[model samples]
Target chain A: MSTIEDVTREFEQIIPSDTAAGQSVQERIIQMLEELRFEDRDVFGIRLAMEEALVNAIKHGNQMDPTKTVRIACQIGQQRVRIEIEDQGSGFHPEDLPDPTADENLERPCGRGIMLMRAFMTSITFNPTGNCVVMTKDRSEPEPETPAGESA
Target chain B: MSQGNRRLDLEEVNGVTVARFTDKKILDESNIQIIGNQLFSLVDDDHRQKVVLDFTNVEYLSSAALGKLITMDKKVKAAGAKLRLCSIRSDIKEVFKITRLDKLFNIFDNRDKALEGF
Candidate 1:
């Protein structure tokens, strides 16, 4: 029998609604993901999801006003990782966003971020106010055992 | 790579203008604006009839950056020029695939391959 190792880590950062700050936040998240030994594809998923959320919070939610702030929190556990991003602006309904992949909408660029986040993360939800979004991705379960003297 | 202005390094190969994005993280608002303007300028220039964006050095691009690409693609087509992309990382490719922009643009594995289309 094998047991799952348990680890819990939490990080919080409050950054002004400046686009420059996004790079630092991305680096921090990448470091954390690397420490957990996540695979390149998983790291890319997390990075892309986080980038989408942070940019939305700063550019749309905060309107890139330096006076406003975006709050981001991350919790990583053995089974899963969760991230929350909240912005200080009037939130819009997520469902109202048009489908970027649609025939007529394919030329549009702004709606794709939400679609990418939905495609990468295991789950994505928004607060009632729509000002905050929570994203989660489950860790990969241990691989099934291979037969003796056989490669996986 | 020396920047022609701030965020992009431009060079002409044969008859195509290859504008390579230099930033590893292209999430900044200002950087997006600068890049978009530069690409639009290339689309408007008569000498630059063929434009290829080399994403060899770009690690990440925000939705705004993708939007700029779409806008540039449209402009390039309207101006009777060509817009091609080369050396896009898999992660970014996933974004393009999800948005179905992969079907909208001509993407090649390398600069030479992209140039061949022109």
Candidate 2:
């Protein structure tokens, strides 16, 4: 039921502005992927999603304060895997958030995280607490690595 | 946590080449090649067993970036190296899981573990 028995696979993380923290976030995520035995593209898909969420949480939500922290969690269920990201800053007005897909926002430097989150994740929700967000994914495909007798 | 305005950084850490980017949503289809090609060059050697992509700076991911990772993995594998991720933010991680990518790449807690895992 748990992927991170050693505390590396499944757990929570707090990030500072230092990009080094970003590296840790990336490592933990990919580690979970390898543990779960996903397909190649599936791996990329997950990384892409995770990256966008973290960047926004750190850069925009916290405004790179380095004082504010971004919190993360990963868990595995029988049929699906779940993740949550929370920030210390006051949440943005969802209505005020720009639409990245709109033609006017197309060339904007940033604002695509929400768009990609909707496209890639099976489900995404903003918490009423305004401090938390949750996302989920299902495991139904073949894995990229097949141990000795397993078929692709 | 300081604002870099979501710029992607590429460099070497723990002797492993990494692409550090801050993206907020699904990437536009056009940006894929630029990011993918750059990341590919870093992890494109068989001896180079690891590539860490830090997402703490990003808020979202588009499928375009997803395709880039898959293709980049292809090139890295052909070269005999490995591709991985670290410190993923949760909201975006959900997208990957929904896409079945949660089961993909070798994700770790940090670069040290990622490098040590190999």
Candidate 3:
């Protein structure tokens, strides 16, 4: 695995408060990850986490205000790859989010961001401003032990 | 979405309705919501049991789109139908792999391979 010191790449992009903007940010993130020598898996998680972050920022934070801005910053370091997404809106507390896996809300379309973030990233945190999210994914780890003939 | 070409192709088999979406990478909540509606209208109870989504032209996908898939799957399964996929490209496959969605959905190498058991 290439350590952060081996290749530390950075990316910064600002997109309009629109869905298409999210795609551009995702593409930029993948390009930056590639420059850091990350393959598909790393890029996938980062893209997923970052997309959720941006969506929440645009939809929830800024309330889809076209005039507002969503800022994204990424840094690849030795320990992990970190991404921060900030919105100009009043932020919501990460702790306050309801669980999407709950039976009562299983059918809901919205509320899965936190779940996916936790499931895919090493850590998902929020800043005090309530409008910023910091998500991290550790460098790839060895595969989990799988019994012979057992599918992971 | 652009109507630039075909993003989805519709088929009905054994009373199941299938709409294969291709080359879709950056779909949002609005378009996905619309697709959801279109999917509901396309698949009737008679054809719900054997629907397939072909990703032959798709190379990448977003988690939001994945959310849409799960929601769609639930609806299809409720109607006693199944939603399966085939011909998923490698780049998009990695998204499914990393997100552990590979285990959540039935994926095949090609359209014929996916529709074989059904």
Candidate 4:
């Protein structure tokens, strides 16, 4: 298996606060993941996480202002990938986000993006102002099933 | 509707409306808005009593897409109609689970199962 030392490819781009531009950036990262032989499930998670983060930056962070822009940086290794996304806007506190999983909020249309990002990424952190987010995902192998009698 | 404007392939199966998403990725805001409108029209305009969302063709969906589904659910309930989802990819299913939306929506393994009592 490859290690962090195998990290090679990197990408950096500044795009308008438009989802089309965000999608292009996502495709480049996903293409790199595929080239590195990342597992399909891992690719799925990473793609989903990137989608959430980019949308948050483009739509929520920049409020889809054409004048605003989003900066994305990515580093891909054989074993892991890291991404940083920063938007031009007044940041909000990540901690203030309502728990989408909570009973009262489950049916709400928004507020689930951050939760999905945390679930799919190995690690996710936000800058103090919360306009910038950094997320990392280490390629993972699926866990083996517990034996019938030994199930926890 | 023009091909570009139609996001769902609607089929009526035994009085139930089976709406299949045509896009492989439902991520963009404009696309989600169009989809949400088409979906809402099922209840608001067409008055579908039983609706089944077939996701077999959807390989990717963003939180905005999920938001549309939640709003659709609300509309269905408001109209006293039924709503169910089927054929979601496993990874996408995990998205629902993480959001605890699996508990809120009636999800099935396939269209047959999703349509079973409806």
Candidate 5:
């Protein structure tokens, strides 16, 4: 995995607080990920995580305020892909979030995005303001060898 | 929500409502609202049970979409119906497993297997 010191390429963009704009930003990031030759599975997970973060930034963080903007920064390296997303809103503590996995919370729909981000990425952290999220996926592990009887 | 702006292709088979969303990337909030309304309406308004969401074409899902699924599942359960998911790719299935939603809802490898229990 590439350490923070070994960033090969970096890009950043500020998207409007519109869902359409968010999709465009995600597509641009996906293009970069493809150029990096990330594994299919990794690309899928990264895309989902990026969407979750971007959605949270646009909806929950900016509250769909057209005047607000979502800032996204990407760092692509030989061994890792890192992204940071920030929104302009009153930040909320990530620790205060309800456990979506808990039986009592399972039925609620909105709390699972953060959990999904954590699940897909190798590392996830929220800024003190709670308005920014940084996530990374490491490519350190070798692809699992397909079993003899199974086709990949 | 309206007939003109349908985002999902819903099919009724053997009393099971199979909702197939075609967007390869379901990352936006607009998509979430559409999917949430479509899935929840199946239970709350249409009163149809045994809903199956086929993800054969969906390559990715945002967290907001995941939340909508949870809401849809709860609505189905409250209506005394079952919601099953099928054809989720292995890469995306990891999200369900990580959130422990694989335990909360019935997931099948394909639509036929998902329809079996319903």
Candidate 6:
């Protein structure tokens, strides 16, 4: 059986604080996941979580400053994918964010991105300074095989 | 609107306006801004009483897109107009569910259902 270190592929890059730049990085990571034959559902969740995290890094953390940069590190394996995103700006407290799901905040336009990142990722963490976030998603188990005669 | 500039395909069905999203991935900020403006115009400019946002062609969207939808819903409600969302893929639907937006907006499985009672 392959361990995390045995099967994992590691990558790292630093990108400009531009949405387009972030998108290119996202596309690269997605292609890697597809190449590994990750399930569609897992891919979908990871893609969503990554988008939110990168947007937060580029737009919110770095404040879209052209001079600032976002660093991304990723590890992809047969059993899981892990990503770490860090920005140049000072981080804010995650607890201070208003709950988008609350009745009073439902109509609010923002604040849902972080919630979504947590929901889609199997595990999510923010550095104490709040400038970086790390997320991971475990590969879903395949559906059990049925007997040849069963309709299923 | 210029053909290339259009982000939604608007059709009037029995006095209800159905606007289908043209893009498959509504993730980018500029694109979401354009879509939001078009959606708000349905009420602010056209003054349409009943609107349905059809998502059959949309396969992926981000929180920025959701923010636009929330703003659209507010405009629709403030104008005393009604808005409904339909044909959202399961993955996208889960996003709404996670944000508790499924309860905020009137959602249906298809356009026909969304247009009902309009």
Which candidate number would show the highest DockQ if scored against the true structure?
Answer: 6
lDDT per residue for candidate 4 within A61-140, as digits (tens), equals 99999999999988888778889999998998989988888899988899988888899989899989999989989988
Once fitted onto the true fold, the runs of candidate 2 whose alpha carbons sit more than 4 angstroms away are: A1-9, A143-152, B1-118
lDDT of each model, Cα atoms only? Answer: 0.82, 0.63, 0.71, 0.90, 0.83, 0.89
| TM-score result, candidate 2 | 0.50
| Candidate 4 ranges with C-alpha deviation above 4 Å | A1-4, A142-152
Select the stronger candidate by TM-score from 1 and 5.
Answer: 5
* Tens-place lDDT digits, model 2, residues A1-152: 22322232457777775444765776677776777676545565566667667766776678778678888888755456577888877776555677654555443444556666666667777876455667776655774566889754
What is the per-residue lDDT of model 4 for residues B1-118, given as tens digits with 9 covering 90 to 100?
4325788999999999999999999988888999899999999989999999999999988889999999999999999999999999888999888888999999999999998978
Q: Please tell me which predicted candidate would have the highest TM-score against the true structure.
A: 6
Candidate 3 C-alpha error for residue B14, in Å: 4.5
lDDT, residue A63, model 6: 96
Collision pairs in model 6 = none
Cα lDDT tens digits, model 5, A1-152, are 22465787788899899879978877887887788788888888788888778878888899999999999988888888889899999988989999988888766766887887887789998889999988999865658889999987
**Which digits, one per residue and each the tens of the lDDT, describe model 1 over residues B1-118?**
1225666778888877888888887767777887787778776754478888999998888778899999998898888888899999888898888888899999999988998848
Residue lDDT tens for model 1, A1-152? 11224546788899999767876887887798789877667777888888888889998999999899999888877677788899998998999988788899988757888888898888889988889999988776555668899963
Summing lDDT over every window of 10 consecutive residues in candidate 1 chain A, give the lowest-scoring window: A1-10
Candidate 3 steric clashes: 7
Better of 1 and 4 by DockQ: 4
Residue B55 of model 5 has an lDDT of 95
Mind giving the per-residue lDDT tens digits that candidate 3 earns over A118-150? 767888778877888888888675456689998
Q: Is candidate 2 or candidate 4 better by TM-score?
A: 4
The TM-score-based order of candidates, best leading, equals: 6, 4, 5, 1, 3, 2
Worst 10 residues of 4 chain A by lDDT: A1-10
DockQ of 2: 0.09
